[model samples]
Target: MSSNKITLKKIAEIAGVHRSTVDKVIHNRPGVSDAVREKILRILKEKDYQPNFIGRALRNQENRKTIAVVSSRVNSEPYLHQGIQQAVQEVGVFGYDVEYYIFDIEQIDQQIEMLYTLAHQKINGIILQALYDARIPGVVSDLAECGIPVVLLNFDHPGCTDALCYIGQDSRKAGRTAAHLAKAFLHGSGRIAVINGYYEKILNIYDRCSGFTAYLAEIAPAVEIAEIVDSSENAHDLYHAAVDLLRRQQIDCIYATSSGTEGIGKAIGELGLQDRTHIICHDLYPEILRMLREGMVWATLSQDLEKQGYLAFQYLVYYLLKGIDPPSKKILIEVDIRLKENMPET
Candidate 1:
């Protein structure tokens, strides 16, 4: 058979399989055995066969496709809720139905269980922001075995076999940026205290802290690290800790690796260190913005929440629809550093 004249029917005949089987293999659908699928694929490659992927995608889109979004609940992270909402809107335009399974990242077992339930529902794809779990790779592997594509949101599942991709910012760079802003505001000589969220569990927070300290060590060695505090995502605890640190140490700068600005700002206010101490933090949450405007917080690193959510859904749709793999294993979003001087008029 001429390569130029190759067709699905001709390929099916050459492979000694039904045209339906060829169709399934061409679209990467399961039910065909691995050996047989490989054989069919080999023959197609030999013939230089190009399937009508666009037509197939159009027909598939006619069916109501289901994509599951698993992330932290709103109370855990209101910013994530904005992302989830954006994702839903973006995917809905492409005729993909999204179902959200909100969970607390602190509840690792419950989050894992929800993943199992979604997989059991035979979801076409899953967008997850998983809590720290050693068993996550196994769970992702199980879903892969069942032919479900998984895209991680705001985090990456490195070494997970067949995990699709991660969508989020370059955390280390954001941290380094925070350090730059802090050093400039403090004139390169100040005692800095680091405030971070669940540093052991959340890799991003750790990366940010690492990046900030690394930069300071390289460039602003005079800006000393007075102390490091892990808030464990508790505002009250962070406030008390911040107050204690302020009262004891001459903390001229605060580098917060997470979104607990409200509590940190309160501590700075109580100590009347609002003008004396310069604080840098992450995210543009309402409270953080308020602090920035009030001159309590110096700068914030924003990881465009809406764009993260929109792109997460968009990439999954591309994979499930056009059979395109993620452009890369990890997509690093641009970090927007917002400060009072350049605060956008919302």
Candidate 2:
């Protein structure tokens, strides 16, 4: 028989054994003799039989699984949200339901409480955008002890080593790329100011800023960072911060390590500094794209947020349904530099 048409029943007939015995051997269950198990294994190997996990899931409705996606509300970038929506739709076909538990960035207690709630709810897996809090590691450990697997999404915590894998961009490398862009824009030396997004609360933002500063120092020591301002990852706050910085100093470039590019672009436009100050920011918000087209922003870096979201969910599904682990512990998404001329048509 063809390998593609191999089945447990067919294998039982060939081996002169009952289907239940074949099932026990296939699933590594006890009660099967070693001779019979080895014979079944040999046939499986020779036939190259592959289990259809989707079919199994479809047939077993009582074994429906739930995956929890937990994150701070502030980190919901648009593309990331879209990717998660897509994952949710796809997983539903395999009898898996995804539950979202979003909390305010400041509410560490609430985030922690939600994790405890999920633990009791019998969550099979988790996709987390981890906060930079001291208490997170212990909670993640508690979940692992309960046999629930976690896949880190977007932001990662070093303490949560129990997580199956991390799926996101290499923030430091993205920062280094930003530094290269800054040097090229400024012709090797100029004053650049950095606006960080929730710097104290998120580890990735800090990593991005550190990468930018270190790379810039190594490549062009003369390109001074005039100021580094921390702002909420929103346009209004970023606008006020940008306006204050622009009024006090003559900045040649502004590198924003997070969202709120619109505010910086607005400040540069209002002060008539667009001709001199080049603005580089992260992500592709609708307003940011418009800013690029209008020449208010120079370029933006994209961390492929949609792919990050999709993979985080899909990886957990594979792990839970097929007993498959991700290919690596650290899955880094590619960073793309977007300019006005090459921005997506949408």
Candidate 3:
């Protein structure tokens, strides 16, 4: 019915029979009842169908496309990992194969090179989390030159070539939105300190911190911005940094824009400052989600992790197969503000 050739499954729908029944009828397998067989034959003749358009017979003729999912340490972030895994699951059902590739977020250059090296291979598609690097434009160009399509997840790499289609939320805008929510919850007056996992290194963290800082400064100038605590991938380092920072400042509010909330929560609880300070962070990890519902964290900003993974695969598959264009320069997903009343229990 559509411009694309109708599949046998579609024909089966028209005949009101299982696709296998259609297959058995077409191949003369003799499993159908006489009436059903006659009905299928009539429908097949009406459609004038002569062949199975999609099957192992045509598999090799079409490219057995390989989609590469390159992500950060997904194991550390459950929801993000879930999103990536869900996208991987979608690949099998959609007739594409996926190869997962991951690297440490700290090793930005190495991660970029590894992605470029994969371009040298037969991979037709890439799902990437764009990191902070000056060479991303060149890397994007190389992938485009090699006819590989790339879909950016979560983070946006500026100066990317035309071949890059981004399917994740706008990192900076997500940050800004979180800041406004923080202001609303805090009532725009308090000394708030910001906790960012990759302060100077990650674009998403920087943008979120920036948005939070800007909105807080605009409506709540009286509220002092205490020093920003730089979170670590190392648990011990993060706990000590947050604890020591909290010890020195009269921090009445805290905003976290990354997944380093576990250590921060422990440190905050150890200091017994939950009564005085209102804590707000991002992501819906098991710990963070529990903290939000338990009133340990006053609120959290969430982006749809599953939706991100699902859309990332969709864009990469589209470009790799049909060279279909993406809709926008950057896709921005809405930020979710979770309060004690609205937070889900894990």
TM-score of 1: 0.79
Name the best candidate (by TM-score): 2
- Give per-residue CA lDDT, model 2, range 80-117, as digits (tens): 66787787665554667777787777888898898888
Instruction: Put the candidates in TM-score order, highest first.
Output: 2, 3, 1
Find the candidate with the highest lDDT and give its number. 2
User: Local distance difference test, per candidate?
Assistant: 0.79, 0.84, 0.71
**lDDT: the better of candidates 2 and 3:** 2
**What does each candidate score in C-alpha RMSD?**
11.3, 9.6, 7.0
What is the per-residue lDDT of model 1 for residues 74-148, given as tens digits with 9 covering 90 to 100?
323456556666656534434467787777656888888888887789589998887667888899888888889
> What C-alpha lDDT, on a 0 to 100 scale, does residue 18 get in candidate 3?
93
TM-score of each model, paired residue for residue: 0.79, 0.83, 0.79
Instruction: List clashing residue pairs in candidate 2.
Output: none
Best to worst by lDDT, what's the order? 2, 1, 3
Report the error of model 3 at residue 220, Å.
Answer: 1.2
